[model samples]
Target chain A: MIGELELILCDIGNTTFHFLIDDVEQKYFLNERLPDFNETIYYISVNDNATANLKHSNDDLVDLEQYVNFKTKYKGMGLDRKIACIGYDDAIIVDAGSAITVDIMKKAKHKGGFILPGLKSIKDLYPKISHKLQFDFNTKVNLDKIPLCTQDAISYAILQSIIEPIKKIRKKQQIIFTGGDGEFLSKYFENSIYKKDLIFENMKRIINANNCIA
Target chain B: MIGELELILCDIGNTTFHFLIDDVEQKYFLNERLPDFNETIYYISVNDNATANLKHSNDDLVDLEQYVNFKTKYKGMGLDRKIACIGYDDAIIVDAGSAITVDIMKKAKHKGGFILPGLKSIKDLYPKISHKLQFDFNTKVNLDKIPLCTQDAISYAILQSIIEPIKKIRKKQQIIFTGGDGEFLSKYFENSIYKKDLIFENMKRIINANNCIA
Candidate 1:
């Protein structure tokens, strides 16, 4: 078995590289200097540039995509998303980052999933539409009541657009929220679990199951 | 009462000028040469440059923002939205143009409303996120079931995000759909009416009510 001290898991997205080391989380931008660690890093990357850059470096890296055996019907699904769904028998996994991906797993089999623009994406979108629509989204706005002002209107729209479909697809399955914006979105659900170390935890599981470590 | 033949109504948005004359609708690009018409035109515009350009011309034009007297608490609400909500007493008025505006009216009193990025805005948004996400939105995708493919996933997200909120806010109040994408969105709801000339019809009603025409 791989000791906790020797295990390092990295999830590289389009803009950032997130690392899990000995129960501690560390994050760095894609363009930032790589951390020099003696341990072999088991990583799954969605960014091609970052993947190529890391492979060329001296850091002993093991690409974990080969070991993920989740049965999903979603073709061209992101590696990060598939990794997050590991060990779940039944769940609605929501990875809310630059893009919010919602996937349903039943009896350890991936049913299907959909994606929506994240909060930052929606926030950046309004200004391009019109100067009048250039307002900060009020995330605290009450969703039950329709908005009376522009700020709330925009806020309500963003929240409702994301939350409603999740509620529609949900049926007694516990929603597992992960990624950057996961906690914020999980607050809206009653039977949802916010797992900050979801991907890394599952990565560790995959590492143990496959006996990849020496 | 002003005869329909004598009244010329124009709803000017950011990109195009939509005119209703003698029950026939005509559209023109904002950059295109202005139509030379003999009749005095009564118009409501959300585009500042188009409004300024029209005002500078020799054609007789009347701005209709001053004539609307609906009671609403929504501050900085667009004149086009307010004009569309003119005739509806108890309904959810949806204007799905460049931006989708949803306003609720209860017994001639404007309760509240919200704004959402329209279909075109969402379509343009995907390619910017990632080239892999560059797929045309499938409007006919079944919103009742979660999507399995990327194309259906995107299409489901757009439709569900827009439609679900309208359904949630709806409680026997007839949903009134207007604007460019109004007809497309209205098909999802049972208790909804698609009014292609909703703004123009309300503009004409305001003219008749206020006796603006001499």
Candidate 2:
């Protein structure tokens, strides 16, 4: 708890914010708005939600820092994702939210990622407008067949988008899920770990590796 | 070869006509012109590329005889899907293509399905419309991440919509895959069978079921 942890991770995106104390710890709450539990170096995330594009209020941000007492590598990163990869090691982080952020981290460096819309947005577009059917997009359930309406179709489209690609990627690397839809997406994408507290977990991993004195 | 086969089954839709002379025989050819195929059953799909709705075509009514040959039960059904569910006892058919079609068959009958736009539609909608570098969708080969593009987003959404519902409904069932985009989707959905020749298989199934004899 005292002599452990290395980096602070902050991931922000559509729907929610996920922050953490260290690589092995759970993300508490970043100020109420930031989403992370702390802003310490032990955290991990693609984009710092607590400080991302459309984060909530500032009060939430302060609440998160009490745990570790640190700040991100950069404030207001061009993209929250940049914040996630700032100082991470070899690993792939997936931010599944309003948009899916796919990024890579190797040798303590972040590589640019692909930014696409999320399950909710894509499904809502077609089902609500064209198919003219009322199906619940957020409703989490297993369906054997397609819904006979517009909404369900939209919902199905968005989720499939994420699954299809991951299935195609041929890398046998460490995969972590973060962001609002992260937890939800975890249920579907196979063999992937869900990191609701990504920053905290990454921080702990880094700290353990480097023997941080935080 | 001719004597062993009892009948010939033909499927006409927006894109092509599937022919099945028997369980072991099948053929598929691109659709050329309307009121063209020699088959009695004409399944009409008024998609964007369909010319069936055009006032220019006068003698193209598939009518009752067509339905009789196609089984009045399958009339007005989604062409690709109807043929897909023909033989499965329990399964969901995902026709991933320019547009996505997720249809499920349960207990050897059409249990209906959901429809939504495909990945391409989502990508094409933006960028060209907004100079703000809007996120596009895609199904990249990143097994540990989601796509970040309009096309991939659409793809994910569709996949989720289909998987979520089917996963819940099947209780315990086999998921089926077909159509142009079937391969792309099957890889992600996993634990599913793909019928590259679903229409033809269906034609054979139907023709053989009725011992379709001239």
Candidate 3:
């Protein structure tokens, strides 16, 4: 007779740490709050400095570069990206979080990728120049051509900043969008599927495959 | 018989005010250091407040939206943009200054336009997030795909930001690029021509046509 499997998976990001255990998911800030979990923690981190401060079995951490099944020429692929690519075998995976990553995975192989500032990050960055330049995500602006007003102009610019790269990469391939702004930006893409907790889903696969065992 | 034509043409922009008179060109700060020129300035402005401060005869300043020969539905179109599109009768006029304006004109008609932050402005905006994000204009980067390093990624993003819009607007039309960063961005664009002082050139035509007399 076998007992129930017990495991704790954590994706240590730059801002927040996402945790999944026994199909229950929770998130905490990397700096402000720390959860009370006692299980064997299997983790993948984008921020090494913050991850180092945490207490975990060193061997249980997932090496994203080695955890993947496919081969990649990019030596500096981040942990978040490597996990996002897992199971998304043959599609363009776009992570629109703090940073927008447009990584092309054609036939289970990483062709290439791009990283640009996210919608929030760009909106935040632009305010330093002119406080009037604001991105209203709720404001529906047409992308068929240039927008007229400042708000719409900014909204369109931010949208194009993300979409243009995907268009450059999308050659009739399915696009899988994930991240904070994925829900908002995905609607604009014709052939895109928005999936939340993608990193957590990838983490589950990685943990189940015993890839997190260092 | 025509007399020796003399005029002071001013381009009131977001940041600086560019002035030209009888082949003598000068610029003044939009806020801090005003120019010492006392000539009756024939001007077009994006900054109405700044233009209001400057002393000009009632008919000296040109109404951009009304002065242009072509018709446009965009009510808030800046004067600099209207002037840039003057001589570019049948082409895409891209002005990459404080703001990158891509206005498509076909057969002497305004099709539509896009507005994005300029390269310098984008570079300036990025540093607020991470001081490490330094934009070295001298560094040449590959825009075929997303770059690897942070600096290269940013460089590629900024370059892509400009190039991608032009690609979308381009439909076998002659591309005319002019601005502070126009010379730099023009190299990446194929079959494109870079022309400096395009606004000034357009201003000459506009003033001679008595568009400012309105």
Candidate 4:
């Protein structure tokens, strides 16, 4: 392994683009901006436009697929899911952001996963389907019981949509929560661990694996 | 009550407007066109734009709020919710369409409800948030477990999102499923009864109640 290797980790999601360099995280609207970088760039994206924005040359921008070694039923397995599998011996990795993905990785074997619209995405959905229907996702609400008003009702419903299914499939494996909404979810699932800069950690692992292969 | 009186039942939903006259159901796209009707009109709506389109003087078009008698925690109680509570002793009424609403009416008491984005709306959400991301809701997929591809994964997740929560809070009350997606959900919840023209039946109930009041 090179002692002075410069690394930049990029995670391109549907709603937001995230980059981690020197342990500092930078966020941008997906496909809006593409930064000029000199370091080795490694990225994983679910969105094609975001990937296009990050595209330079085939050799320069390394997609997570270049390093992740796994077989799954999901033909086009999302890079985030692959990263979530890394370093987890047996876990249910949940990435709750523009989209909510719940993947189960047991003993390095990809079991399968569920993908649903994220809370903010679900909030945006109401107005689009119905005219003049307004929703506020920033407002705090109680999820223990049902709500009366429109705002609270939507908030509780979105939270429950993710939580209810995970609760029903109560696996013995550790639950790893990541992404922008990860911290908020940690409060509800006391056993779950909220991880920050997971993409960066995964990038390092990928680099290590590549070095071994070389 | 006059034995020769005419009745026109209207259900104004987020996406489609439904009308029942002479025991035949007529469907139209909401806000697209306004139908000319001379018979006594009865309508229920959650959408203001759809409601505004149906407005024909004050007395001519009757809102469900005027006929249905019930107290709910929701200040602007959606007409669909109110109508769902009608003609039921103890029931869990689920309306799955542009928006899914699961309302609890136990012993004729409104016990609040859960509202989440519907199937088609959830499918549309992906492309709205991401420019290149397109999802097809019509694609058939397995809902009993998680899926592999993005399309199947999304389809399964949306179905599970609605089914899992309702399954958790399994009350002994009769479960009544309605709306465009009602038939599909009926297949999942075998114990539940599928009611196609529930809004029309509720309209009849409201008319009976209004007659008693008069």
By DockQ, the best candidate is 1
lDDT, residue A203, candidate 2: 42
Name the better of 2 and 3 by DockQ.
3
Please give the lDDT score at residue B151 for candidate 4: 71
Candidate 4, superposed: residue stretches over 4 Å from native: A1-6, A12-17, A27-36, A42-64, A138-140, A212-214, B1-6, B13-17, B29-36, B43-64, B130-135, B138-140, B212-214
Q: What tens-digit string does per-residue lDDT give for candidate 3 at B4-104? A: 56767778777787777776777778675565455456677777787776753233344444556656776556667778887666898888876777888
lDDT against true structure, model 1? 0.85
**Distance (Å) between predicted and true CA of B39, model 4?**
3.4
Error of 2 at B153 (Å): 11
How would the docking of model 1 be graded?
Answer: medium
Tens-digit per-residue lDDT, B1-214, candidate 1: 7664577888888778888887788888988787568778899988899887776663688888888776788888888888888877899999998788999999998989988997899888877777778887787898877788999988898888898888888889899998789998999989898998888878988888888888
Per-candidate TM equals: 0.94, 0.46, 0.83, 0.86
Query: Model 3 residue B103 lDDT?
Result: 86
Q: Judged by TM-score, which candidate is best? A: 1
> Candidate 2: where are CA atoms >4 Å away?
A1-78, A84-98, A102-114, A118-121, A124-150, A156-214, B1-79, B109-119, B122-174, B187-192, B207-214
How closely does chain A match the true chain A in each prediction, as TM-score?
0.94, 0.53, 0.85, 0.81
**Runs off by more than 4 Å, candidate 1:** A1-3, A33-38, B1-4, B35-38
True contacts kept of each: 0.79, 0.20, 0.32, 0.74
At residue A39, give the lDDT of candidate 2.
Answer: 37
How much does each candidate deviate from the true structure in C-alpha RMSD?
A: 1.9, 10.9, 4.1, 3.5
> Can you write out model 3's per-residue Cα lDDT over A1-214, one digit (the tens) per residue?
0115666777887777777776687777867546556556777787777687555324344444455565687656776787888876678888887778778887777876766666776776556554444446534778886665656666777678767867876788888889988888889778889999788777677656764443
